[model samples]
Target: MGKGGGQVHMGNKAFSSHSPSPPRNNSGGRGLGGGGMDRWTGVIHVPLSGGGPTFRVAASLIFSPAKTLAVPRANAILFTGDRVRGSGEPAIERLSDAAYLAGLLARKLAGEANAWVVDAACFSRSLAVYRELVPSVDAVGDPRRYDPTGFPASAGVANILAHCVHEIQSTITGTTMKDSAGIQDPNASMLSSCPPRTIILGFSKGGVVVNQLVTELACLESEPTPALSTHNLLVPVSASDVLSSISEFHYVDVGLNCAGAYISDHAVIKGIINYVLHTSKNLRFILHGTPRQWSDPNRPWIGMEKDKMLNLLQDGAQKCEGRLVLSEKRYFDGKPGSLLMHFEILQVMDIS
Candidate 1:
């Protein structure tokens, strides 16, 4: 991507953002949607770096900052794991493929200057039994693991195209705030031209991916080598590229009634602790939760698990020489749990 301008690319081709969203169709997953904003929607078959199974997932993108982006131009990039939805288009429409709700969140947080937003839907969807993707089901329909491997490749690029808007700008070093929920600070002098970092977030059932990714990071000594490789809509991306680019890993109101929602295995947390403390780059973990998921009677353990994960990450951060920072934000506190509050957090999570 060139500075001051970038082009929209998908599947060995680049398109102009000067036009409105393309006509919608069921079979073709590539197109644009929402208020004439440059957007792309499609299905990508993402591979697992650890070599288990490829995810047949749907993804959506909102290009900001004068359009057209390529690898290495990102100010910041956000990978979002969507919450559960009902069957049919109504529910899933807001997620990875439909690109409605996720797009809204992108517009609110990443906007046109802060970071590029890649909101992902599950490879498959059904209902409360399970809503979002990431936790691939087993032969008997039980979730197996939460792996955020090679996801950028699934978004149609060897590296994801990025664009973001913060109050004005943001970098890891500079200081800025978009809202009460988050802050931005990119060094205009030192990092204005440097490649932006990454932020990975999982909401609701989608949070499972966040849990899995942190645990997996502990297991990585180097870049992830793929056992299988395939690309169609976008360029192929290496697992290491996605992994190394990450700076902030966020678990946003994630709870799916599945094992390891906030990491059930303590050993996995310990491994992450060691990995972050020893890593060269700085890493931060942010947890944004609401009373809806935390105080549910049906799932009372939700809050406890969230706290457990937060405490473990805090412990890890404390052990490191400020190389790793752990932070948490609780929204709608004291407010009774409600579905409105559950979905509302997406638009204003305040990921500064």
Candidate 2:
């Protein structure tokens, strides 16, 4: 299971603050302009409590974008879900594998010059020990059972993610910054330009985070409210930036060990529809599923929830004035659901 109690004192320092490893050629100069891009892997301690509070989750981040040496501006940015652990594999050793897969997924979606900010899970199990999948959920119990009873403080998670993006932008631009007051110092990466558009993806169990994000999307206002809560003050990114920077949210073969794998809250779906239809925001949700999760007789709720979500989103998407989209895809339909197919979907699933 994941552990968050130990990293409470990490504060808001970027993983780069700990002598970040130099950028390496991960792609071997084949796709990205005949040159691999720069990749930085580190962990960011996310503060759940406001200013000088006690709780925080250590979210591992990997910044792998098109070669920053030439094209500093990322064509797009991705905030990906955690890569699951294989039997007997250590989390430390899996970092490179996760980073590699993230890069591959980014390239598949948007050729080169894209940024991938991975929200890595602890113990390499997506959403394991610590109950919090994102800042909106309580970081206390078993995450698989972390039930979001009602509307969460939406801005909290989005703000944390946006600050991570800001840090990536700062590192790419080589901007040095003075420390900000309080434990939320990750925002120390001073922003020099507009935020890069983001595409959020949560795979397998990691879809829990994506689920919460869509819930937050429903809570976001048309004008986008400013830092309304104490925790919001910790990050530097504005509310509008959080709302507008995201272009798509992808649930890649998402499944859970519990019920309600996909979003079951109708009110949240309605809120998302209501906001995007009237507001000037364009958002798309691509629900990608494999038989491993969909056809399982043991966990049929997974497929049902995915269908309900797709239906509701599609119903609302029509009136969104091209501002919202919902796409449902079923991969590996011919092959029976198996453990191998579950993981293989990572390399073969269609992102286009």
Candidate 3:
């Protein structure tokens, strides 16, 4: 597979002056294939002015702002933690993590910093977690009664992340888009709203969740209304009616190591790539990971070939015409794990 590139126009404009060009075709030493994939690539260099050690990561996208899509005023971001991390825990833990992610999003949008941090591991068994994450923000539905396993399915997980994005953006900009109808039905409303140029970061189970959501959202883009029902009770809804309202969709997949054993299937990755390639061509997908185990290597956290995983990503980019940018590789020795890498990638400034 080779990277494919073509022109994209944002809104009704003839050309976009803001889109960054794709990265140069460097396939010899790098894992990428020799054929130049039609994709935009760039390096987001954020110097850590203060705080911990400074680090840099490369980023890639499909659209060139210079050719298409007007640069929006603000960039909305959504971050979802790993399954075990996102589940089970004190309410405060979850809120603290959300707050941290919000802080990172704020900093990135303001261009005041390079990275931000969010603890996705905090899990909450009760609704109290919602209170801590957003004291002023109210859940569209009852968190106490809500079952993470029900409704939206794994794909709906992206809706949760999307909801977080809406809340954070609203809190920072005081915008009303968050209150739109899609809050109730993200699958439908997601594509209708044409969400702001947004970046969604998901880990472990969260990655699968986001993948499902993106796939569904892409389907909604064309069909808008699918005769698909959830739990055979919710009834199929019109995605076009809902998703058309949003602007942009940028997906970032981190903690690839935590993806567990199931996601290693090439079919799973290819499914995601095909969806992005055919449906949301403008979307940006990023995969972040390390070669170390979550716990001790002797114990073997999850059986995954680091080389194979990286190759899968490279293949996905080539097959889907999307750029795959790798972050600095970190090794985990038997010691306390540092949040520095997470902070560097997700850290944000106090824009408010």
Off by more than 4 A, model 1:
1-67, 71-98, 109-125, 128-136, 139-196, 222-236
**Cα lDDT, all candidates:** 0.48, 0.50, 0.31
- List residue ranges in candidate 2 displaced over 4 A: 1-96, 111-113, 117-176, 179-194, 222-224, 227-240
CA RMSD per model (angstroms): 11.4, 8.1, 16.8
Instruction: Write down the lDDT that model 3 would get.
Output: 0.31
- Candidate 1 has its poorest 10 consecutive residues by lDDT at 164-173
Better of 1 and 3 by TM-score: 1
Candidate 2 C-alpha lDDT tens digits along 129-220:
22333443333212433233332323444445444433433444455323222223333332223334556677675676667667666766
Query: CA shift at 270, candidate 1, in angstroms?
Result: 2.4
- For residues 1-352, write the lDDT of model 3, one tens digit per residue: 0111111111111111122333223210111111221222222222112222211112221221232111222234353443224434443243334433433343344321111222322234421122222222134211221122212322222233333323322322344452322333222212122223334444332333334344444444234344322211111122332232223333332333333322344654565466556654344443443332343265253434334545665677776554333332343334453343333333321122
Model 3 misses residue 129 by how many Å? 12
| Highest lDDT scorer | 2
> Model 3, clash count?
50
Error of 2 at 3 (Å): 18
Which rank order by TM-score, best down to worst? 2, 1, 3
Task: Compute each candidate's TM-score over C-alphas.
Answer: 0.60, 0.65, 0.41
